[model samples]
Target chain A: MSATPTPSPAHAPDAAPHADGTSALLHAEGLHKTYGSTPALAGADFSIRAGEVVAVMGPSGSGKSTLLHCLAGIVPPDSGRVLYRGRDLSALSDAQRSALRRGDFGFVFQFGQLVPELTCLENAALPVRLAGAGRKQAEAQARQWLERLEVDDIRHHRPGQVSGGQGQRVAVARALAARPSVVFADEPTGALDSLNGERVMQLLTEAARDSGAAVVLVTHEARVAAYSDREIVVRDGKARDMSAMAGVA
Target chain B: MSISHTLLGLLETGPRHGYDLKRAFDERFGHDRPLHYGQVYSTMSRLLKNGLVEVDGIEAGGGPERKRYAITDAGITDVEEWLATPEKPEPYLQSTLYTKLVLALLTDRDASSLLDTQRSEHLRLMRELTRRKTHGDLADQLICDHALFHLEADLRWLETAAARLDKLAKEVRR
Candidate 1:
């Protein structure tokens, strides 16, 4: 793997900050991190405007997931900065960041990670309940989201009783129930077949757009990336903006 | 789609008159443009002559007698063979976009604007498709997906072409 550094002048650390007039909801500059001998990110710069859907795509082990984690404040970069709405994320303590994540950032993972023991409605309502909403209110919000995703019939069934696609729909409903400002979905459709994957992607993007939330989606599939407003390709821990070439098709 | 094979396949369900065949075809596949009455009658007559179809019955109608056609063994075999064979993939190497690129270069026109225009058009169509997919039924969703995938490919090509415009211009000039 010949790792020639990519020149990303537009997102350089010293470049004009928020030059796009405060529309940027999330930004990362010169992010570098390493786990022992393996470097996960090497000066990767990224940013997404409000309500935009950006896809982070690369081959396996190319730091796409790491970039997502860093931007979401789940993992701290050893060097460089991450900003959410112009505030540096590195300055926040673990608890504050955790609270921020719980309240403002929604996440959808490849396997859904829904609690098998909990019913679909409960799983969807968990985040809202964690944010201190009453059980009734949380469940009501969850039910509305489930209906939006067209999986309201499975509200009473546990995750174990639902198919993989239905489980992901429930997961998506859970992710968006809080109306998070940003949604980080890491291969949300990876476990499903093509038809099911398309359905999930359509529903996810539409719901996110309707709520005016920015999305940072990580996927290696071109078909999935097509749904996003832009794509950033990570190579050898370096993020390259491919969106400029296509201008969000 | 093969018109004769489609007609035969429809007959496989049950015998139908020319008018009924046209209605069924329009309902299933020809929603955009229904088949002409003359075309349907001509196809049925040709199929009967080729022994792929046999007249099952003739019924008195308002004007002319209506002939109901049924698929024979040969027609059934033809439909099966057609279904089994894969359609040829059209690569479209010399599409209109490519022609326009070269023409712009030869005429010393601004090729970049052409690319930008095409990109916008592709994006517009994609937005339209996304709307349709969101509201469409399962079949409509599938159709929109097919078109969206192809348009995505076209957008990628347009971007790649725009990136190589300078080099292409030089090559074309030489």
Candidate 2:
């Protein structure tokens, strides 16, 4: 509340990004965002510890998406650095950032975001394939992740052929097939009903933590964040409160 | 990593039979990360039961065959969580030393000597850290980064602890 920051994570687990005590796997230091003078993140400082799952919640217009985008380096922060493994996003060239994003990060958006034309396994393996993995090897790893995510039953089904929740699970499995350093999601279950939403949440939470990747999800829902090892409430475009929950045993 | 953590850490190294984990852990940690043989078997049983570790299969033809422990996706998840769990720094336990504090009244040995001895050990540790870079298995940047932090923590704890003990010893002399 007094605005004194915690340590800059110079002595943390180095493996975790968030504040879950895995030691700042994803750290956004002094982040500020502006959309043509409409402020989004107001000098926000946030991090996702390694193996942590964080849910960001706020009212509409509260800049949840802005924070996610900024942290993910999808939207440039007007100020502040997004640090992954101690390297700042602002310092990387666009191409460099893209390659790191492709190799080291995974994303699940509000929509399923599945490429409709590809079958579930094909879509799930896209990132791996993009990384130049052979089609056979990529699909094989994708099948493993899909099974781990409990979506293996639909591996051959296209996005349009599956239920919305099922499609989103596929999206998550796809995002994680590369075992990225961090996984980012924007309103991951905003499209599904309660049961589906909860299922997706648990699956994402379990899958990400098991893989030791930091998962940051933006939502207005408290329950969604509860599944994470840490939760930070962003309000008025600034990180207002932060707390950590025990990691699931 | 604790005992279960030790087992999980071994799994991260790659698949191994149950006994292989025990031997590798002993080799990796030396006497410091000691384990009870029963504890290793217990951990293996639980991991298999919980679906975190799977028997990748058996290697036969050598007596009673052996089951290899590979981390299932769930096992890795468990290890990640274990790695990420909040660590309440363990209390600096040197029971014999704490005893020295309580029984220093009865000792005739010089107090400064103890301080000097401990400080040297700490300095040696810090010096070795400077000379050390993880060269082998823990070569990944992420894992190495974490190890560095832990080492730094050890160094800090040593310095602060040694300083505190020095002060305590000086006060006791007064």
Candidate 3:
């Protein structure tokens, strides 16, 4: 977690290379992200192992979100590459990229994006159904995830009915329902109080380790970053070596 | 370093049963600046409130009251940061201990008592460093050599001061 990734280490890293140049699960070299004329990321270089939790942090507009989006194939990077399990995401076709996004990555933003009108269980299971899973079985899997996350009691409640912490926990269970290899979460605990924030952070770190899914959590709070195994700080759209104190794991 | 800073460093080593931490601190650091029991427990409580360290469990009875403390990620972040930032060790030279020793010459207490303490400390440190240099390999080569030089300088200073005291003949006493 302390070492740098290899140069041009194959696409879709299954494990991150150490400082000595070993293999990693994901690697991005010379990664650059821009929006029209403004640069959101500048030739950023970062990587994560298959089951390692790496937190990315920075000041507002430092390009954390853009980097996450670029890595997940939700947005294309201006330059550089996003390699997942040996394939360059930028080189994949749109449908192939979509399939990867739907099947290989799980995302959770500050907003859980749960359908407000739907029951918590339905909201969590809907993604499974959309992924072509049978409804009953999908919900059963969803229920299991809910129970695992300690949100099973809220299965029939709406997002509005649960506490912020409980809602986010549900969101996490939903994201993990399909067992994606990676989970990109932005400010997962930003909306909660310190008590609840700590609870959520612990849950996230536990989830990543238990599921063997690498995590790229983004945040500005040092307390949140303390939960991560390692962290990379972004500044002026470039990934920089953060001294210590910065994201959520 | 201050007692509080040392306490924080001890807590940074992963969760330790409070009593065990106290013993480790005493064994490793307290010889120089002993951490009072009250101070150690107080610091533990403060660290817990600050979310840097946590109490994992409590022993059922008096078997040292398993007050295990662990360094949270935030705590690691803190120490990582401390290692990164430059430390100003020169200030320690002018700390209260040295200043008090220097001022002791103006009082009725025999300077021999203070000299005895300093001489004992210097010899002990020199012996420890010599043993380490001969057998234990330091992880950082340059830093270890630098530390050895610093200790050597302290020993030399102590020897010179002891000679100066012997030559004074009570002239500067009154």
Candidate 4:
């Protein structure tokens, strides 16, 4: 609504440190990953601040998912470093990285990935439960998140019983239930129709902002990426920050 | 948009002075560009001359004389026809972006970067529209959605162009 554009809090890709000198919540530099004989990421660089939604966009197999995997410590890069809150992810033990993921990071995939056997409420509470909270406390927190995401009415149903849109909302509620500092969402709205997709994006973004959690969203759809504060385009295994590019041009 | 037809439609509800018509037009339709008083009066005069509207009353105000106008039966028929007609879809066979891309290749410039810059510009507008839609009412949301979809189409073209830049460069040089 303001005449001036909203200034992005995300750090520029090429900058060694941010202009303001504040460290990013998660940062990766010169990352390279290979699967068999193919290179997924050659030399990608990325950074995100707390509460900033940065969409990772590219054509299929262009390494957007690889960049996200490296950032989240799910897949180690062959040649570069990833820092989470100034702590090197590679330096941590495998157990430590897993622990960090459980306690400090959240994830939402295109398929929702809800447990087919668990009730929606139980599925939403799984992350918090795994993070060492008591079942009652975890379920209570998850219930609140489910309500906020507008899927609480279907809390007693299993994943198979709910609609795709409702299931996706439950997955989002699960991701936020642990109060993670960052949420890694890869095509969270990819499976839904435009109306359902937009609604999911609206709720996901609004809930993430309210929780003050940064989102590294991997999406090829421009409409979905539009929900992000800024975007990084991964081409040929490299990342380019569109906002930073705009600033330079 | 046809300002005269729009003004006539507004008058269909009831007779309104020129100033009141402008305000109503602005509130409902004019968002980015509001109707100027001169444009409103000129449009009203044209509609009156065309038998689409008639002067219902004249009121002498403190500053100037105000004329209240009402829509005629002809105006209602005109609005119906306009509403029923489907707008022609633009083919965009010749695109400015295509021209710029070809020129960049011809001039030995960084065509890929040009596409990147344009893509950024397009996303910037999309982001603005997205934010507006987040806080806007349903009407605002629909309007922004239309603009957002168009910009998204442009961005998709940019992506495809970037992917085929090498092939395009080969053809342009030959």
Model 2 earns a TM-score of: 0.53
What is the lDDT, from 0 to 100, of the residue A69 in candidate 4?
91
- Models 1 onward score TM values of 0.65, 0.53, 0.56, 0.93
Mind sharing the TM-score for model 3? 0.56
Best by TM-score: 4
Fnat of candidate 2: 0.00
What is the descending lDDT order? 4, 1, 2, 3
Candidate 2 yields a Cα-based lDDT of 0.70
> Mind giving the per-residue lDDT tens digits that candidate 3 earns over A1-249?
112111112213255455437465667778887788998998677667877777786668889888888888888887788777667888899999887767677778787578899988998887678778998988987887787777888899999999988899888877777667888889988888866776676676676666677888898664465456666767678885332222211
Report the error of model 4 at residue A246, Å.
Answer: 2.1
Candidate 2 lDDT over residue span B94-145, tens digit each: 6555566445533646543453344334333432332232223444333433
Give all candidates' CA lDDT scores: 0.83, 0.70, 0.69, 0.86
Docking class of 3: incorrect
Give per-residue CA lDDT, model 4, range B69-165, as digits (tens). 8899999999889878997898978999999999999899999999988887888788889999989999899989999989999999999999999
Model 4: per-residue Cα lDDT over A73-184, one tens digit each: 9999999898887778999999999988987888999994999999999999998899888999989888888888889889999999999999999999898888788899
Ranking by DockQ, best first? Answer: 4, 1, 3, 2
Interface RMSD of each: 5.2, 19.7, 20.9, 2.0
Q: List pairs with backbone clashes in candidate 4.
A: none
Give the poorly placed runs of model 3, Cα more than 4 Å off. A1-22, A241-249, B1-174
